[model samples]
Target: MQNRALAAATFSFVVAQSLCGTLADADWPQWRGPSRNGHSPDTGLMESWPDGGPKQLWIYKNAGKGYAGPAISQGALYTMGTQGEKSTLISLDANTGKERWTTEIGDILGNGWGDGPRGTPSVDGDRVYAMNGGGHLVCASTQDGSILWHKSMSEFGGKTPNWGYTESVVVDGDKILATPGGEKGTVIALNKETGSLIWQSSDITDNAHYSTMVPANIQGQWQYVQRTEKSIFGIHAENGSVLWKTDFPGRTAVIPTPIVFGNRVYVTAGYGTGCKAVEINEKMEVKELYSNRLMKNHHGGAIQVGGHVFGYSDGVGWLCQDLESGEEVWSEKRALGKGAIGMADGKLICVDEGSGKVMLIDASTEGFKEHGSFTLDPQSEIRASRGKIWTHPVVINGKLYLRDQDLVYCYQVQ
Candidate 1:
């Protein structure tokens, strides 16, 4: 009788463990969340923190060495990192800091700033898609550390950019899109299931940049919009034909993903590149609305709420920029230092890259308002001395996830 009771208890525990990361309702299945806009659809979150910060649920210190954030899906948290020579994909129990599995994708792609993977894995039903620093794209099983198929971006005549391959491959229905920057083809789509070539942006052969592409629906027509070093353009989703292109000279490196709202597409870069918004019509014509040094977001990613965009703008600090007009609503440097940002439930979640300071602020066009803030303890000491906390904060399923190289923190914000 005692043995039977113990067996039943063990089975019950297994069932509960299996249900942890599978809650698709609030899962962050891809980069920049489900919409790729850095906005979480979660609600009922705490309007303000009590004191230090929301309760730190747990911290997984063995996240390996990487600056990438976690992608939560199906009761699991998916991410990548490196130990020594191998850059690997790691899956963890979302509710706990325990690692479920790890798969070696390839050798570590060394970089001056940091090493290991930079792109977050895009999780689909049972599979997760990710790109390594060496420009290898792998489609693997989310259930276990098993590779279904792997392909190198160089196979399509694409070369790694200065900062490495950081663009999270955009996955649409039945297809996966990636940029192999160079004269060969800027953007290429492949069969998400079989890894077969679908089409490449043949006419527009520009080198790949470090920004993720966003899917746009212009007047009921389907298209993909992206920003490169030299230009911002849109391509047909079906055939990968260039629909419209506009030259916007980008300085240094253009890291932020292009923002799309209604018919307007906005692009911004660091090193005084500033910001530019262009309007595209259904006729595939492009016209510039405004360009200025208002929100020169380096990489922390700006989020659009209502009619305002919020991000950590260089020089100007955390800024709120108007979407329709390229004007600064407000800029506050005292609230937080320049870092990666995210949004959920009408609040801005920002982490200072230099210091491990995490802040929660009101996402308002009126001005910068702080609710509460806290500094990350037990941060990654293994990180490089010159390294900054470059990983963007991700909030999903009423929880907040942030990374400092190998250290991953989970907090209850709701």
Candidate 2:
């Protein structure tokens, strides 16, 4: 009897362990991926794609109109789009691309490029957060798309930018951080669970641009680093106090999120404005290390791999630059048109916005070398006349997700 009891107990324990392992989430829960650095934690991906690109497993139509990316967590995918007369939050099964739920968040934003949300939905545990282009912010339940709490950026003195609110709010710890740029504050931290105000950064009163905030621990001090059209600054994550401020000659639009490497912060912009790097010490002192036009990344987003930064410069084409020295490593101008980029498994997956062409290349400092390239078929006929395939490439859990207006294609990449 004692031997039988021991065997049963061991069997139950093993079953529980197996269940937990299967349910564990491998997710890209927010904009710019899990770390907001455009890097994927996934490994064992295809080092080189087949001639026609990775096999397309499924295609999800009716994602609606938006440049927003998808956020995958807990087996569900979340994104924003215009469902009808209103901007809507959408949830779908990550594996099968089946519609789960949709919740209207705000009025549809009208733009020449397209009409829809610009920010990706951010998923946090059982809740998800999204900001429509109309400056309306909503926190919704991840399961049924029920709105938990909702707030507008206008309540915090935020004026919608000319292109609309394109920020993907950062949910750090117990607080949700957002930029509602005005005289009242440039940044605000709200209670994630209740949607109440915590604190606001009142010192820097700059107008909000399209960039998102990145959290960094500098010399043991945790803060949120953000960039505006005129400045790059850091605010204390706890009280929203201004920690450091530096000048950036950003013009036209500053659309890329600031990249924080060690104690150094790097920012880039488009429309003739270039890139710059600044170092912040423990004492909160700021010093500019280098500034140049080597990386005039428009809105495609930039990623840092080791000590080098890679992105598509407006006129310079796709290039790699040393993060610290600001020296150009290598550039390829004629290979691909201007587009967004993402990284996975030590490789770069780049998409050309003009033609919906996808390319897989080695993320190497030696030079630009293409591993594989293919153009997206059945491109959207409803895309704005001015809008190309503007959405960035996202790779997670062996699947590659790409969007062209209402069409969301899933390809097996592992």
Highest TM-score: which candidate? 2
| Worst 10-residue lDDT window, candidate 2 | 18-27
lDDT of 1 by residue, 259-368 (tens): 99998888889889899998887688998999898888898888888787888788999998989998888899986789999998889998999989998989987788
Clashes in each model (backbone N, CA, C under 3 Å)? 8, 0
Candidate 2 wrongly placed segments (more than 4 Å): 1-24
Error of 1 at 49 (Å): 1.1
TM-score computed on alpha carbons, candidate 1: 0.93
Clashing pairs in 1: 20-75, 21-74, 21-75, 21-76, 22-74, 22-75, 181-208, 182-207
**Tens digit of lDDT per residue, candidate 2, span 169-280?**
9999999999989999999999999999999899888999999999999878999999899999989998999999999988878999899999999999999999999999
Please give the distance, in angstroms, between residue 361's alpha carbon in candidate 1 and its true position after superposition: 0.6
lDDT of 2 at 78: 90
What are the candidates' C-alpha RMSDs?
A: 5.7, 2.7
In model 1, the runs with Cα more than 4 Å from the true position are: 1-24
Q: Which residue pairs collide, candidate 2?
A: none
* CA-lDDT, candidates in order: 0.88, 0.92
lDDT agreement of model 1 with the native: 0.88
